[model samples]
Target: MFKNIVRNIFLEAENANVKKYVKQISGADKLDPIIVIKPNPTWVANYGWIAYNNAMDQFAIYNLNNNQRRDKNSRCIFHFRDIQELHTVQDGICNRNLIPNGFHVPQGLQANIALGTNNPVPIGRAYLVINLEIKKLEFLEDKKFFYVD
Candidate 1:
């Protein structure tokens, strides 16, 4: 299911700059990296989520730019705290705008979230899953930014 979604996203999009960045992050041979969400080893998985969230935030910035282009009278300054906040806010806005009643996922996905809930486990578990699609990785070939000097 995840693979299908990723494939769809890739097929339905075209972003040259983003593709270049991903290629730089991952090796040339490895075009699409499957990042799994795990409990242990905090850095890798968390960083993956952060990157995905950042990409979404970039999309929000594009949207804001579009709004500015469309409406001359509307002046809105949007500030985002990292990509995670942008993703959360964008998801909320999308749900509110698209869905009449609101969006609801199956219980299994969010059942573990219980930080403030009146349940046995007072502390909640933080977890995330994200899939990124790269159109092309050619820009990484000549880029030294991703390398450790």
Candidate 2:
């Protein structure tokens, strides 16, 4: 599930000091970063997209800025070792219900929707809020994952 499912949650940070934040993430031992997944009321109110999951226990990062890593806004990508680390450090409940009314499913995830099944595998987006410090995240500038389409 970890390998193929949820990978990177693109955080769009505006007016934030990225260098300082990076230093805090790398230097401080007690820096517990809380990553808010979509379907988050606060996030939806402020930004406007609810990333809902369809499968139980399926956790994935919510892309906040919708991949617009531009205009003094930087994207923070946290690389986890595995699923265990993700589960151990995470500190929130994931809504496993299918995407509710009024939520726009991004074009990137349209292909992930299951075609025909009452119980579909978790091929769509996942919503999770995680603590980065406990997971011992590593910051990689050039690290990228490839998908076979």
Using lDDT, give the best candidate's number: 2
Kindly list the per-residue Cα lDDT of model 2 for residues 36-122, writing each as its tens digit.
222334433443332322211123333223543211121222323444544442322223223232233334654774322222122
Per-residue lDDT tens digits for candidate 1, residues 1-149, read: 33333233244434563353234334322223222111122322433444433333333344454543211111111233344554564465433333111122324534553322221110111222222344432211112111111
Task: Report backbone clashes per prediction.
Answer: 0, 0
In model 1, the worst 10-residue window by lDDT is 140-149
CA RMSD for every model? 15.8, 12.7
Which residue pairs clash within candidate 1?
A: none
State how far residue 48 of model 1 sits from its true place (Å): 27
Residue 57, model 2, lDDT: 18
Compute the lDDT of residue 143 as modeled in candidate 2.
15
How far does residue 71 in candidate 2 sit from its true spot (Å)? 24
Model 2: worst 10 consecutive residues (lDDT sum): 140-149
CA lDDT for candidate 2: 0.30
Clashes of 1: 0
